[model samples]
Target: MTCPKPRLQALLSAWNAPQRSNAGFSRVPSTLRKLHGTAKCAEEAIDTSTRRHKVIFSGIQPTGIPHLGNYFGALANWVKLQRNAAPEDELLFSVVGWHALTLPQDPKALQQARMDMMALLLAVGIDPKRSIVFHQDHIQNHTELAWILSCITPTGKLRRMTTWKTRLAVSRNANDESEVDDSLLNTGLFTYPVLQAADILAYKATHVPVGDDQQQHLELTRDIAEGFNRAYKTPSRLFPLPEYMTTPSKRILSLKDPSAKMSKSAVDPNSRIVLTDTPAQIKSKIRGATTDSIQGITYDPVARPGTSNLLSILAACTDDDVLEVAKRYHNRNHGDLKADVTEVVEETFRKPRAEFERLRGETEYLTQIAEEGAAKARSRSDATLREVRHRVGLA
Candidate 1:
């Protein structure tokens, strides 16, 4: 029996769909015979199995001039990544000024700090041409995308974040979480991870170079991407799952308290080495650094943290292995090791310090570079925002 004309057309349309695209025409129902025979051969392509050099996205807060920990842990890796980047590779290095504002900050000081940070990044070899280096606030899309991601993110996840908990413990005089009311813990601090995820996904970054401490946040970024993709059911992956690129260096420890990481927030100024430290300041800090009355120097982080910390710093600065550095000072006393580490640090920071001084003097040039970088960043971010908006039905 012959099928009705309308039924035939319906069958034809169904047969033309992708599910039946691969079926042999002879086996297709007669109603879809004409449609099946007219189909083009499926594109035969080889799965090259080569991995794409993923886009790398990393950011630093515009707190102040970066300390030695910041230099060795993050900025140094950023320079190496950018220098070796392929033509197709994408890299974004942002000065996260908004993230800096989660805590109370003086307006004028924050502004100055942001400008100083941009110059320092340039002096440290973050080429604006190779990587998109800009202030986070300049690209409004970051906040816009962050708001959207926050909507879909579970409150439990934010509440469980280690960073907020650590900050609260250090800042609050009260013992329990209830003592510090919601006012003290602002929405910005609580939802900062979502914003961080937005920063990566906004650029569709596929690889992130971060310290072990930041691996948790990168995992959160992946979850956000997967959740958004599953929710929207997009044809293609909306965001690439970012992989972490870790450096071999262990966390740089404080000079004053070798147990703790070198941090800008340390109560003692001598605890951490600032990138802009003068030769005199470096010498004084090294001279006064806390070290036990140990007879010999060896790399023992657990037993003699002070000497070990110095050795680690030396190894990082000179790009030598820690074990090898320890062997160099195998039977030496603490004084010899400390003096050697101090010298290496001074020599390593010398060129960057000079560049920073030159860049700081040329304020006009620095301003121009920041503006140009911000403009380029904004253009790329705007495109991503448009696609995201369309996906979420905002468009």
Candidate 2:
């Protein structure tokens, strides 16, 4: 792999100098400054690391059966990462139950959803022997570390976050900004970034994969790590600011409304395709997808978002470039494009869907995997937390 530029390398070298105990914004390198508030900075940060500890951590909410967006945007990238990662690298995937609690949930439903999510992860090829998979709530250290990191996280930074603000605005249907106040939001939603920071820090994860929408949260995670290292003034930093890896799949849009992302919360069931959907259901949904009256097929996102979304899905499923796929369909009609998309979707998900169904019945197997994975996760996180507590005078 290629290394970072010499200037960036020099700055990072100085940043990690043993004699330099001061940690402040003014000391941040110009290279980092040029890339600040972006995922590239985090990527560059990791590229400069001389250490070989490549720890990967990621999480998903156990909201229910994952939709197409979840499969393509996250699960697929996870499987790819596991297959390609080095032998010594550690990868942790979590069914983040604590994150799911940001919204009200039925206890019984949540329990079943957690198990189902675990089974799905295994079914999709996340091998228990190769990668660690667990429910976030099972390992208590995640919350413990989050509380410690929260002490150094600034309230102003959390307030400036757009995610919670936009979510609140949408939930209240607030016409103006004044209507969407802090009272309408929960503390869990507001401080969720700190919990996420702890999730990475607890593992001392060197790499984290997230969607573009969550890049800001990763930046916040970096800030929290720097703040902790600065405040404690330990011999060496306890945490390594985790870098962000871009997901392989592009953002999948809603079938019904291309303007919005594919989500489970969409009112129309047909708006999103779940992994469990049968071939017939997939065909029906694709056939009913909204497209323009344009005669010939071409890749024009602005002019024809619906058709462009179908083409994007095909490209993702077939592991081809969108432009290349679009070229082949230049002479075809909308029906021809939809037909091809349906076929690819069925072929891609057929095995995984069958595996998911079969694994859903193996409750004991899933339980064992989760228990073993949680134990492994706890062992590593406990040691990190113990050292963090001692450094901060909390031990």
Which candidate leads in TM-score? 2
The CA lDDT of each predicted structure is 0.76, 0.83
Cα-based lDDT at residue 352, candidate 2: 91
Model 2 steric clash pairs: none
TM accuracy, model 1: 0.84
**Which stretches of candidate 1 lie above 4 Å from their native place?**
1-51, 171-183
- The regions of model 2 sitting more than 4 angstroms off are 1-34, 37-49, 168-179
lDDT of 1 by residue, 18-82 (tens): 32121221122331223224333111111111346557889999886788888989988788777
Tens-digit lDDT track of model 2 for 12-51: 3422343321122122344355447665654545342456
Overall local distance difference test of candidate 1? 0.76
lDDT of 2: 0.83
- In candidate 2 the C-alpha lDDT for residue 254 amounts to 94
